[model samples]
Target chain A: MDDLNLLRDLGRALDREPPATLVRQRSRLAQARPRRRRPGPLVIAAAALATAALVLVPALLRQSGKAPATHRPGTVKAVNLLLVGADGVRGDARADSIVLVHLPADRRRVTVVSLPRDVEAPAACPGATTGGRLSGTIPNRSLTCVTRNVEALTHVRVDHVAILAYAGLVEMVDAVGGVEVMLPRAVDDPASGLKLSAGRHLVRGRPALAYARARHGLGDGSDLDRVKRQQALMAALAKAAREKITNPVTLARLVNAVTSGMVADRALTPAFLKELATSLERTDPATARYKIAPVVPDPRDPARLVLDEKRAEALFRTLR
Target chain B: MTAPPAVPETASDADLIRRSHDDPEAFAALFDRYAPMLYRYVARRLGPDPAEDLVGDTFLAAFGRRDRYDLDRADARPWLFGIVTKLVARHHRDEAARYRALRRTPAGAVHDDPADAVAAAVTAAAVRPRLAGALEALPRRDRDVLLLVAWADLNYAETAEALGIPVGTVRSRLNRARRKVRAALGDTDPTREEA
Candidate 1:
C-alpha cells in the first residue's frame, strides 16, 4: 500500500467510538444562550426613544423654528447612560459588552468607558454574597443588576440603561450604510470567520460586527484588545451617523433598524432622548474620549481582573 | 403564530443550521451528526481523553456562530471540521507528543476481521512507526492537510475549506507531506512481500 493508505491505517488504529451520549455537553448546549436574537416589543419602544432623539429631534426643532440648543440650563447637569450589548434571549441574556456613556453638563465632550465583561464586581443578585463577573449579574437581575453593580464600581449614578442585542447592533450599522474602520494589520480570525487585509476599510453590518467581535487572531488576543476594538467601532459608528445621516429616508430606515434591536428603561422617555440627542449634536467624534476602566490581574485568580482601585477611583472621580 | 415545519431526518446540515437560528434546539441535531466523526478524528490526533470535550466545544462554538454560517453551502462538514481543527491546533504539544509516543511504541497484534488480517498485519507491524515519525516530523500545516485528507476522508475542496486555505495550497502541502513519508519509509517498500 502507498504511504497515504498506511497513514490511513495508522489513523484507523487510533480511532475509538465516543460514548453513546454526551449528556454533560448536551445540557451545556441546552442551557447556553444562543447569540443573535431579534428584539422584543420592549426593545422597540426603547429604540423608538433613541431613534426619536436621533431623527425626530432635528425635524422637531426645524418645525418649531428653534435653533438646536447645546445645553439646557436648570435641567439635568450630566447623564450616565449604561449601554449593555447583550447576547441571547431577552430574560436569559448575558452582557457581552458594557459601556458607560458619560455625557457631562457641557455636552461638548463625550467620554465612553468600557468595562471588561470579566471584571470582578459585587453580585447584585440576592443570595450571592461574593463578587462575581460583571457580565454574570445581568441574567440574574436583568439590566438593573448590571446598573447597580456598575454604579457601585464606578460610583456614578446610572441615569438610564439601554440593552442592545447583537442583531440590533448589526441592523443599526447597516441602517447607517456601514462604518469605516482602520485595521493595523491583516486579520484572519477563523473562529469568527472574519477576514480582512491591513488598511482602512468601510465594512458593512456583518463585517463591522465581525471586526468588533473577533478576538482570537487579533492584537494580543486578550479581552483588553477586544475592548479597544469595540471602542474604535463605536467611535466609527458615531462618526458615520454624524456624517451620513442626512436625508429623511435614511433617517427613517435608521430609526426602524435601531428601534427593532434595542430596549431602554421606562425612565428614558422620548423627550429625554430628544434632549440627549440635541446636546450631543455638536459633540465632535474627534474629541470624544474612549477609555477602558483601569484593571489589574486579580491576585488570587490570574484569569479574572480586579479594578485598579487607586487608578479606578481617580478615573471615576473625573467622570463624577 | 404558525409552528415551524418539522425537521426531517434527511435535512441537510445547512437547512438545520439555518433553522437553528430561530430554534436553538435544531443545533443539537448538528451536534449528533458531526460529534462522533469529530471525536474520532480528534482522538486520532490527540488521543481519546481530550477528544470528547474538544468535540463538544466545536459544536458549542458552531452554535454561537450559526449566524455567520453560509446557508448556501449545503454540507456543513467542512465548516464543522474546520472548527474542530482549529481547536485541535491549540493542543499542538499534545498532538506532537502522541505521535512521538506512537513512533517509540511497537505495533502489537492485528485485532481485525479475518478477511483483511494479512494485509493489516503487514501494514500495521512494519509501517506504523515510520508513518508516525513522518507525521511528527512534518510541518504542522502540512500535517493538517495530509491528515484531514487521509484520516478524515475530506476531499481536497473540503480540506481547503476546513483549513481556510486555497485548494492549491492544500495540494502542495499534501504532496510535500507525502514526499516526507516516502523518504521516511526509504527502500523498505512495506507493500512488497517479504522474502
Candidate 2:
C-alpha cells in the first residue's frame, strides 16, 4: 500500500469508541466555571453615578424613539439593545448599520443579529412593501419603526434602542484610540470612500466610517458580506471597549461619545451603559455571535427583502 | 432579497476560542467538538483509562490558555493535536511497553491498543509489529513528526505548525524516521529519497 493508504488504515485503527465516556466532562466543567457574577453594590453605585452623569445633560437626551423610559432596576434576565448607525448623523439619514445585541440571562453570551439595510424589508414596514431599506428611518419616529419591525420579525422584545449617526461611529472608534480590523484583501471603493491595502488596519474617524460604510467596494459588494465585516469590526470594538473600561480617560471619552452622538431610549442611560460595559467585560470576545437576519428576494421586485420564515425562526429561537 | 435566506455560517474553531475567552463556560462547546478525537489519540498511546482523564485535562489546559490563542488560524486541529502529543509523551513507559508487547505478539495485538483492528485488515501485515517497535525506538521529536503525519493525517505544513518546527525540519525528521521504520521491517527501497 502507498503511504497515504497506509495512514488511512492506521487512522481507522483508533476509530472504535472508547469503553469510557467523556461526555460527562462537559457538565463537570460547567460546575467548575462560576455562574455569571451579579452586579455588586459598588457596580450598582457606579452605574447609578454614570446614569446621573448622562441624565445631568438633558440636552443630549432628545426624545426621538419614544417617550422617556421610566427608570427601573432590572432583574437578571436578557437585555435586548437596538443600535443603529445612520449615514447622516444630524438629519434624516438611512441606516448604514443596524445591530441588535442579546445579552443572555447568564450574561455570558452576547448574540448580535445585524439587520441588512440594503434589503427592501416591506413586511417590516407598515404599509410600503418596497422600502425595508428605510427600516431605521421612517417618518418622525424612526427607531419606533425599526423596533416595531424587528419585533414583528424576530419576536425579540427590544428593551433599549440607540440610534447613532455616521459621526458617532467615527467618535466611538477614535474614543478607543481606533479599532483594528483584519481585511482579507485591500479595499479600494470610492463609492464608500474606503481605500486601504489588504492587512490589519487601525481605523479611526473618517477611515472607520469608510470601513463601516464601504459595502460597495468589499466582498462581492453584497450587503451580507458587509454585515460580516461590520461584525468583525464590532467584535474588535467590543474587545477595545473592554480594554478601555479600566482606563478612566478612555472610559470617559466612550461615555461622552455615546451621550453626545447617540439618541437612545431612556432605559439606555449612563447607568445602563456602565452596567453593560462591566457585564460584558467578563465575556469572551469570540463567544459573541453575529447573525445576519435571513432574507429572500421579493418575487415582484428583486431588490426587496421578505423574511425567510424557517431560517428566521431558527435564528430567533436561540434568543427566545 | 435576491440573496439566499439565511446561510448559517459555521463558526471557525479559532472563532470559538475567541468567544470562549470572555465566557469561561463557552469552552464547553470546544471541548464537545474535540474531546472525542483527542481521547482516541491518547488511548492509542496509553490505555483507555488514562485516556479519559488526560482528554479532560487537555481541554482544561486548553481552556486556561485560550486567551493566548491565535485568532488568525481558523482550524485549531493542529494546535490541539500538538497539546495531545505532548501529554502522550508523559506516558513513555506505557508506550514503550505497548510496542514491546506488539513486537512479541504474533498478530501485533496490544491490550486496548486498537492495533489488532488494523492488523486484521492489512494483508500479511507482519511488518506492523516491527513498525511499532521502530516507532518506540525513535527519538521523541522524530517520532512526533512521523506519527502526526502518518497516524494523525496532518500534512507537512500542519505537522510543522503543530510541532512549532519549520517545514524543512518536518521533512527531514519524517525522512529519517521513515528510513528507520523501513529498516526495522527489513523492507528495501533504496531508491526512495531519505534526505
**First chain TM-score for all predictions:** 0.79, 0.69
Least lDDT summed over 10 consecutive residues: which range in candidate 1 chain A?
A50-59
Give per-residue CA lDDT, model 1, range A127-162, as digits (tens).
432257887535532577788889988898898888
Q: Which candidate is the best by DockQ?
A: 1
Superposed by TM-score, candidate 1 places the C-alpha of residue B62 at a distance from the truth, in angstroms, of 16
- lDDT for residue B12 in candidate 2, whole number 0-100: 78
Specify the highest-TM-score model's number.
1
Give all candidates' CA lDDT scores: 0.77, 0.65
Please give the lDDT score at residue A247 for candidate 1: 65
Q: Kindly report which residue stretches of model 1 are placed more than 4 angstroms away from their true locations once superposed.
A: A1-41, A48-66, A69-74, A89-91, A124-131, B1-23, B31-195
Q: DockQ numbers for every candidate?
A: 0.24, 0.12
Which segments of candidate 2 are over 4 A away from where they belong?
A: A1-75, A122-136, A269-282, B1-195
Model 2, B104-153: lDDT tens digits are 77752432455555564553245556666777899989988987887677
Error of 1 at A174 (Å): 1.4
For candidate 1, the C-alpha RMSD (Å) to the true structure equals 12.9
TM values, all candidates:
0.57, 0.45
